[model samples]
Target: MAFLELNDIHKSYFLGKEEFPVLNGIDLQLDRGEFVSILGESGGGKSTLMNIIGGLDRKFTGQVKVDGRQLDHTKEKQLDNYRRGTIGYIYQSYNLISHLNIVENVLVSLDMTTLKGSQRKERAIALLKKVGLGDHLKKRPSQLSGGQKQRVAIARALASDPEIIIADEPTGALDSRNTAEVLKLLDQIAAEGKLVITVTHSQEVANYGTRIVHLTDGQIDGDTRLKPAYPVPQEDQSEFRARPLSAGASYKNAFKHLTFTFWRNSLIMLGTAIGLFAVLLFSGLGNGVNAFIENQINSMVNPNSVTVFKNPTGKKMSSTELQQSMQQFANDPSKLLLTDDQIDHLRDLKHVNKVEPGYQLSTYTVSYNKKNSSGSGIQTWTKAFSDNTIKTGHKPGDNEIVINKNQAIALTSAKNYKKLQGKTVQLTMQWINKKNQPIQITGKLKVVGFSDNAQALAAATNYHTMRQLIEKKNGVTKANYVSVNVTNSIYVKQVAKKIQNLKDNNKYTYGAITVGDILDTINQYVQIAAIVLSAIAGISLVVSALMIIVTMYMSVAERTKEIGILRALGERKKDIRRLFTAESILIGLFSAALALLLAYGFSSLLNHILYKIVKFNIVQISAANIISTVIIALVISFIAALLPARRASRLNPIDALSAD
Candidate 1:
């Protein structure tokens, strides 16, 4: 049997149910090492026959057998393998990828073989040397002469060492000298025990082959043998080798294309980075603001302690009901006042260091020599104030008070504020009793010092002073609230929980409020605000994704021929899809990296400005935020590329190769 057999092939074109025959009842047989040319005029089915034999046209009815195995054109994968392993096509237009260099173009075919890394590159270089374009291996197709381009095309076709060479109008565009060079190269290919088939219109081109077949209209009209075919070479079967393309090759190809369109890709990345930057910045700002607020609150109060307020109604209440009850108790303090036994019980709880009784008078008036202040509150504590920065004198003793600097200025006038310390002041306090009667208490206290600006409008003293005054006026010394100090800050929450569950009268529940609780509420609001702002920023990400989709579709349209070339080189459908998808992922990665860099720079500058004013770093970007930004970018890019990648993979190689 001949090495290749085309038996009774029939092909046609259809237009609206009308059949137009192109090739009818064509039968041919050829063996290895035979240079055969199909000579024909225009519209004589020369190109159509070449397409059928090259595995580019699979819709025809034919039996094509090569090396005793029948070709199943209906199976796309089998056709792909045949095109990649058995046939090499040299086109009239020299369909070389414009972005790739000469040697890189050859590597496109060799990449499909078992040769890896430097071996594949060496093979490509060797093939280019054979075609006499070795010195121009790094030049692009645009930079090469027409003859050089054709030589590079020949080198690429032979890169994978296929068994057959198909030249379709190979010299149609070349000058006489270059035409002779290409024809001589074809003769050399055939001499190496390979089948060489040329399709042409000129008799001079046909004469270069050993055999000539004339086709007047679809059917073969004549056949002539000029010289005997070269004898087939005897080589070890183990020498034959090929392998599938690797992922590294795909990524390399993708990187080349991306760099070729650097400016365009950079524009898309900038848009995407803007969206990610907004999200990351706002998230970091929210974190920083929360931390600052917690730090401020902790500085003012003891983080290792909780303040317990007696429940007013001796029953469970909703927050709203609790607020109303607390308001009522505030107006009439006697109803919610804690007794000695309750304070002692709180001190015995686990993790509790001690319980200190405290009194707070919200409606108080302080007067010193006709300079008076009303609506000023007074608080007495058991623990010494460590956070307070006193401007003069010291913390309050049992009979002394430390007034806020602002309040002292308001009471004594700003000019006399410094001299007011150590002076006696009269305090008058009033509240409604449990019997629904108004009560008033008055006491004289000596001012000890002025606190720093943080303490807004309150005065503080030791608990003994407030207790003695309360007993003298109301005839009852009941604690309004008790401060329960835990052994360590780490146990604050646990101790607070126990204190909140403690009952004052075995019926009323106590409420425990810690510095951490207030900070948590503030942090919750800050996070909500951040999320809302980031969501607004995320609107731009949607637009960016749409831009990526449009860009990928444009890439598919622009590289349609390149796609066909890759498919012809034995790439699977998924491989083509992966190539495009990998490009999108690279875009996402670039955008994410740019966004992170911009966010870091902006945060650093903002923190520098803020630290001067607030004495703290106010922008904190976390690792998790950076990771989330990257993952979001990748997911969005992957989703955007899906349709374009799928469309590119599904394209028909013949149609794509023919596209303008």
Candidate 2:
């Protein structure tokens, strides 16, 4: 069998919905180590034949057999491998990656083979030297001459050591002297038991080939052999030479270059980082503030606390009527509130604990002599309540008064103030007379145990219970209801149902809700904040993605020559696509890592300050938030790079090289 075979290959295209044939009935074959040159006029489909042979375009009908493998019927995955391992291609324009050094550019094509680090590096360097680029291994393509760049392109093609080296006008860009040099190099490679095929218009370059074929209108018109051909290798010769690296190595190479490339563009990195920072910071801060509010509300009252108030009576009570109510208050404080009879009935139900009747006294300021401060709240005397203290006085007796710890502290701190431990101080009360005058009292009282009831006061309320105080001063009142604290918060619903089942009239009603409900009601504003912050964060992420698109598109434009170079040097279309995608994924991962670090740093600093003031570490971030941010970054990066990658992969080698 011939080393390579193409039988009646036909390729066509559709322009404006009309069929246009590019190649028709091309029959060609060559044994191994035969140097064959194909000469054709411009647009005569010589390059198209080369493209088909290189496996760059598969839309054709023909039988192409290379070493007994059917090239035309090959699967997509196998074709990728064939391009990576079985063929080496060189183009007329010196296709070299501008961002890569001479050696790195050559090694890029070898990434798909099985070569390891040192070996791969070595093979790439040897090929560079063979192509006369030994001293320019560290130089980028732009730093090299046109002849030197084409030689580097040839070296890159040879890195995989394929059975055939397909060159399309390899010396087209060179001067007479450099053209002779490139032709001699092709002769040498062909002499080394490798099939060298060149398509060119130069007769000088074709004369060095052992055979010459002429193509006219996509058909081979002449074939002449002048030397004995070498035998085609039966074994997989790709493995004997340096193979491309593994998939893992490809990722590593992509990451390494990506790092260098981004760092080289410092301003872009900074912009991306700033955008990511905004997204991270706002989300963290919003979640933190919401959590703090929830903690505060949860601490002050049960998340499940429910207050019941009686529907108001329209007519106002006369002073006489209000006083007569004091006569009935002597029996029990509960009667002034829920009435003792109602309390007795409520307490008999399951899940019902003691029902405490309470009333609030209006806020006030306390003063001794020349010392006054406001913001004092009071609650009705409940036996179970434990949130306040009277520093130097007992509970308010019928004829005396008790002051809060803060008010007592301020009183004694004044200049010329006496140690009023037992000294009589005037308690100026409000609304005492018919004209709402303040009552000055000199009731003497001893300082007893301090009541720890001050903290329970939200702002301040004078919550005095008994009816006698209201009757004497005209400021207090009998409460209309009692708060029944259930024994078990979880069973509050059961207790409410039991109360509902009581035979009381419709005039009596009760309700209970979970602590969760109260928190939801109080923190309803948090939802708005979360949305606002998330949107702000989301905008930044979108900006980051747009930035990525701009950057990658610029990269594709800047590296058009490089993409063409890779395509000509055995890189499949998918491989070119994957390289760009890999670069983008790396960018996203980097930004996400940065966002996480910044979020953690800010969260820690803010949490410390808040904990000192509020006595709670409420600003907590969950794992879901972190995961969500990282996933978002990755998706954005992948999406942003897609268009650029596809554009790069679809670039025609001829057009890409022709671009400035």
> Which ten contiguous residues of candidate 2 have the minimum total lDDT?
309-318
User: Can you tell me which runs of candidate 1 are displaced by over 4 Å?
Assistant: 237-244, 311-335, 374-378, 382-394, 413-419, 431-438, 449-457, 500-508
Give the clash count for model 2: 25
Model 2 error, position 291 (Å): 5.2
lDDT for model 1 comes to: 0.84
RMSD in Å for all candidates: 3.2, 7.8
lDDT of model 2 at residue 611?
A: 81
Q: Give the lowest summed-lDDT range of ten residues in model 1.
A: 381-390
- Measured against the true structure, the TM-scores of the candidates, in listed sequence, are 0.90, 0.72
Stretches of candidate 2 off by over 4 Å are 10-24, 59-61, 73-78, 116-119, 129-136, 145-148, 175-185, 231-257, 263-265, 290-377, 381-520, 567-577, 593-626, 646-660
Supply candidate 1's per-residue lDDT for 371. Answer: 77
Model 2, range 174-246, lDDT digits (tens) per residue? Answer: 8988888888888788777788889998777777889989888878888877666655445553554434345
Candidate models: Cα lDDT each? 0.84, 0.66
